[model samples]
Target: MEASKIRLTVPEGIDPSRVLGAGDGVLRALENLVRAHVVARGDSVAVSGDPDEVELVARFFEHAFREADAGRTLSADDVSRCLAVLRDGEHDASSLRDDVLLSYRGRVIRPKTLGQKRYVDAIRSSTITFGLGPAGTGKTYLAMALAVAALKRHEVGRLILTRPVVEAGENLGFLPGTLEEKIDPYMRPLYDALFDMMDRERTDELMERGVIEIAPLAYMRGRTLSDAFVVLDEAQNTTPEQMKMFLTRLGFNSKFVITGDLSQRDLVGRRGGLADVEKILGRVDDVAFSHLERADVVRHALVGRIVEAYDAYDDVREQRSRDRKESR
Candidate 1:
């Protein structure tokens, strides 16, 4: 057997050190993963070893260079993810890396998973998109990103972020603070996402000018939202009537995103608004439902396993109940 060698010229304007990673850590990681001797020189990377290993290394960096060309700096996590995708052959690196949506303060926001990519696409193409999934799937976060992008592009006049506050487990009037203070906790996630995409000063300015509205879902009643981007988060907490009211509030030239986790609904003793509306309008034109499963979870790796475990438990519990009924 003979050693095969391949070299890749790093693209100009992309720091070769970044492509290879800080202190050549990324090169070492790639070398260890692909069983190859990786070397990086001025504006070029060379791979030598087993022919197959050399080929894998070449293909892996090829994808990495493509990502760099697309305005993405390679991170250690990205290196691992791209390597896995290349090995598994389920999806290409370009699908995971291209299309920079928003970049703020050195943070590049784009879909980190395939489901998120579909959810983003649904928001772009449909008038209403339901981001149905478990926690950590970037459902609400991605919707907020898209809303911010639309606002910046002037595709919409304003941004509306609302969520049902049922999860508080406390009555609103009894809370010690004012209405804004009372609802702040429930709306914090939306605010966090917004601030992540925009500076605090600008976010506050937009909110003060009424260009961005963050309110409890109750406030959406009797108002038509025109030329705005609206995101209804934690939608599983809304009653059917509330959902209907919110849906009807969608005026012309607006985009609406509804995100929820069906398993985590806090609504008491009645069907959740998200589930009800999904059944009723699921077949309607220009409305999309992008369902994300445990595999789409982008949080700490354990979260996906946790979601899968809970789903399996629920399945067994349901089967046991059915068996008990059959015995009767």
Candidate 2:
């Protein structure tokens, strides 16, 4: 079979150098576009192979960067919509627009930040989604939002939230009270997200009704979850075996959102479950993995900066430790 070609028309009045950069620039852009089956660059950018892919890419460039020289600032929403068009193979823009506009529980769930939108879409389409990144990047919050949205739309019967209860090297056995009580602190972030989406009284009511269930990662073993939206928060603390077990527990009619900050793993000397999942299933079809970087963070402005700072700090520490070990 012959490889199809795509001709991309660079708009006039816009500096190709600036837009495409020098050497390898145009190739990189075309590579991204082609991933969506849009176009392949040659003497001139042309769309071949799939007719729908060609038109979609053409429309995306036209709508997104057509007026670049006019000093038009592309908002985050614009970027999100364009990406959604590419990610979803559907030719109809109306459905993408409608999904983007759809509100959950009177709160407009539009993907204002690029990562948030990607995470939401992944959660909706894939049976399993891995949201990995630093803190304050909406990794857990966005997953909770999607889970809540699914529950509200009756796509799932209940919401199950779980996380490893490892904190400050404290063993779960040493903690006072029952299993739930011991794990509540570690799972507080998940609870906080629920409270934000649902009213305090209503959230409590649901908890009492068992419509919303929170548990430690240990309790997730030996069970099959069906007709539920399960979220594993702070998954970076889970060992590789635990992560595998949790993922395989998904029964029929169930979806999972696993969120974690790799740098914050509490399990010393043990690999993070979330990281292991990404490594093992990155290329698996029907599984979506979205990464939230520091830029996509929309919390307090300082939060984004803080995440970046910690990332830099960790990088430096790792490098120094490696150097010292080599020297020894």
Candidate 3:
């Protein structure tokens, strides 16, 4: 057996002594990043077994050397931190694709951002997943994508999408039309995401055939969903009891993805189901939760900034509320 070797191309203006810091410490840290790569040719590093791992090692040295040439001091600990990030795929450009791509309808659907990837993975791996984040972060979109993929793969018999029918500031009873027509506006976001993943005509056909079902959270009670992918979008508006009822409906082989923006809950009362679920089920092992920050917003660039602005406002408002209570 022979030990693997990694060839390093010391670029001009970067002193090798600076990288090593006049000792073997930096060399050892670099060795950990190299793991199993072998020098196949000058300036090229190769590793047997996994191409992904080899590329990871190659990228670390590339970034490390660039920092060294810029007169930035590189300690062994810094090198270790860089390797850790790379190993976690933070620096890998294709990390999002590797995590979220699913082949469906003869096309590949990949999440546009890291938040979307985490949301999809959580839905797949856990019996229940909560995608809590600001608007435009793909929480609803990825959940719909997962539901479509599950149906396409025959892993589930049907797809059920629902949301609370809470009106922001209006009375739903005053709205004309049948129950379904009145509630359609609230469920539009869920429908839009579904339409994007599946052809509109085909989606219409499925809805008519009951293969795909969309309704309000009120309709989910007294039912057990077996072999189904159930997504509750905009769930923050659900009352705590409603949220509990939905979770209990998870039957054999069914997966549930519940997505909401806590700050936007329209439930009026302080006991929204989405918030309660986060507090109660957050510690459960088989349930996964992904909280997306403004950085994970993958919509229009402006949307990310808007999310951040709202977050800052909310933080200030919350602090003021706390201060008022304490003063009393």
Candidate 4:
């Protein structure tokens, strides 16, 4: 069988650097992904391999260049997503690439996966959004970015970040520290996300002025938060009563994002608040629930595979449990 070849011309006035990425990293990634030998010359990229592989490779570059032409810098994550689309034989994803949610300092924050795009859209169109997924799915991070953007745009009067300190479990009384000190560890992720979106001095200033508030979930009790962008992280640790209290606290002109991984809940012998809330409020209007799966894990490449492995294990265990129950 003879090898097939396709050459993609670099459009004038479009930076090849953006399409190729730094040091040809993007090209290399594509080469590793597709069964093709890719070469970049003066003003074109050549893909040579099997006829079928060549066609897919061509489409991949074509999709990526469209994004580059539209002034979006393509990263490894973008390349990975494009590869996934190609393998899945999905149609064009140019719309996903074009939807820039937020830009901070020189970095643009956009959804890298289809699930994440839906998650961000839900946050924008709904008064309450639930991002339920495993780690590295951008559940909390994207919610934080959206919340910060809303506050920066003056769409809301304040930003409130809170999470339950359930890692201590029932032995919380033994923790030797004041209330603030005891909860600081659980709230560090929220603080880190805030600092990522705002400078330390500005974040501190906002905290001092009450424009940005970071506190434990207990701090949210009995307070009606109005005109605020509120995010309750690690909601899986909250009890059903706590979840109801938090949900009822949403006031006029306010948006709430409740994010948690039900699989990672630490609420000993009790159902996760997020799970209960999902069952109760799923059909309610103005509330959206977006779920990200293993494919949405945007951390290291192995993280997605790790999630899949654990999911497989859980399925087997569940089957055994069901079989034993039936036998009884």
Candidate 5:
């Protein structure tokens, strides 16, 4: 059989090391995965193997070079991710990785999947966005990134992060110290993601000056949120009335992002606000909804499988219930 070969030339400004990786480990991974005899030197790479494998190796470097050309460094995992995305052939690897929502320190936050890209785009174009998805799909995290980005760009006057502090009915004031202390635990996740993007000193400064507000959903009642980017996280625990009040609080020059897992709602004997608003505002002007699926889970790879498993179980349970009711 004749040998099939392909040579890739790394762009001028992009270092070959960035595309081919600096370590022998990742270099070997590329060879093993692509099943090609890879010899990388200077600005050029040579892949000689089966025609199919040679093409795979060529595509891998093509994406890696593009990522490097865009000034985004690719780690080994990123290289692997790029290869997988290219192999899937459903999405453009550069497009998914290039629209950076925020960059902090050395970390670049952006959509990892096609669904996430659509969700972020909806958030950008709509006045109100509902991100309904399973856990670990980057719904809340992306919203936070965009909210911080907007605040940095002076597109909004402030940022508001809130969630329902469910205690049967969110009347948690009966538990402990001031309302701040009472709700502090429930607010920890918001604070954690916020501080990740900004230094603790600066985050505290914003909190102290009221430039960034982190409060319970109950606290947001009867207030006008103007010129702000408001994120309501874990909104599935909110009641219909609470959702109404929260949406009505939107003032001029403001954007609202509500994120929740509808299947995980904990609103005892009451309909979840995220689910309720979906039916009402789905067709309303300037309001949008993005439904993310298991494929969008950006946590561990196992998380996507786990979400699929639970979704399957839920379907079976619902079907069984319907069967039993029909037999009566």
Candidate 6:
């Protein structure tokens, strides 16, 4: 079959170079990926390729330009996300607009990819949501945004952010000044996310008043968390007992978002509680498990490729193990 060709017209309001990226990097990626020849000619994109590939290129432009039109500056990461959404078979980019989860101080927090959108939606509708994915997929950040948004809306009385401090799991007294001081390094990410969404004064006030409590997961035992939005970050380091204790702490009118990168689990001798709970809660009601992939990574463009390489390496190792097992 002969390769088809199409000339994509670019509107005057949008710059072709912006969509194409600096040095035509995105263009080169498209050409190499779809095996299509892409070129930017005076306010339009000229491409020759297979019919489906041509259509895909068109959809990518549609998604990218839609985001660009929605007041977001275009980037190579945006281009990659657009292509990811197209590959995921979701064509509409309109929902990516006007859907500000939270807006404060000119910083708008919203899902940048379809996978993130699903994860965010799951957080909204579920009692317990597990955002299991690689790093930089916005799992923890988006969960934090939702928690803050819910707090602002008065849907929850308070917000509780906690993470498993694997380094000082139960031996915090041996470390330093105070309990808070000892775990400060491990819990800084959660505090950083809170400060990003809220002002330091308000956050500090809430902490002083105990409305917004940032504590290590070990402190959660024997407590019923009620009327709050609770987040368990870095849950993959949790043991089964700790996970049960954490889940059982869910009190009335509370929501939980457990975000972790299972691949980065730090448990050396025991299975990660997140891995266990996923299998146990696969069929439970009001529970959601959203998985993000390498393509869902929204950090540096190389991050997604790095995730892909690691995934491929893991696949090879697993296959080799299976082959050895068969021989034995």
Ranking by TM-score: 6, 4, 5, 1, 3, 2
Tens digits of lDDT, candidate 2, 1-328: 4544556666666654433335534335554644344433432355565555555666656553443554543443344445455556553332333233233256644454555666777888899998888787777777777777778788888899998878787877899999768777887887777877787887888889988898888888999999999999888888889989999999999998888888786788876777667667989997889988786776777987888887899899999999999999
Instruction: Order candidates by lDDT, high to low.
Output: 4, 1, 5, 6, 3, 2
Each prediction's whole-model lDDT (CA)? 0.84, 0.71, 0.74, 0.85, 0.84, 0.83
C-alpha-based local distance difference test score of model 3: 0.74
- Candidate with top TM-score is 6
In candidate 1, stretches whose alpha carbon ends up further than 4 angstroms from where it belongs are 1-61, 68-92, 98-103
Candidate 5 stretches greater than 4 Å from native:
1-61, 68-91, 99-104, 168-174
Give per-residue lDDT, candidate 5, residue 71. 71
TM-score of 5: 0.79
TM-score of each: 0.79, 0.67, 0.71, 0.84, 0.79, 0.87
lDDT of 6: 0.83
Candidate 5 lDDT score at position 192: 91
Estimate candidate 1's alpha-carbon lDDT, on a 0 to 1 scale: 0.84
lDDT of 6 at 205: 94
Backbone N/Cα/C clashes per model: 0, 8, 1, 0, 0, 0
Which RMSD does model 1 reach against the true structure? 4.5
Off by over 4 Å in 6: 12-14, 67-71, 98-105, 168-173
| Superposition TM-score, candidate 3 onto the true structure | 0.71
**Residue pairs with backbone atoms closer than 3 Å in model 2 (clashes):** 6-45, 6-46, 6-47, 7-45, 7-46, 7-47, 8-45, 8-46
Clashes of 5: 0
Q: Tell me the TM-score of model 1.
A: 0.79
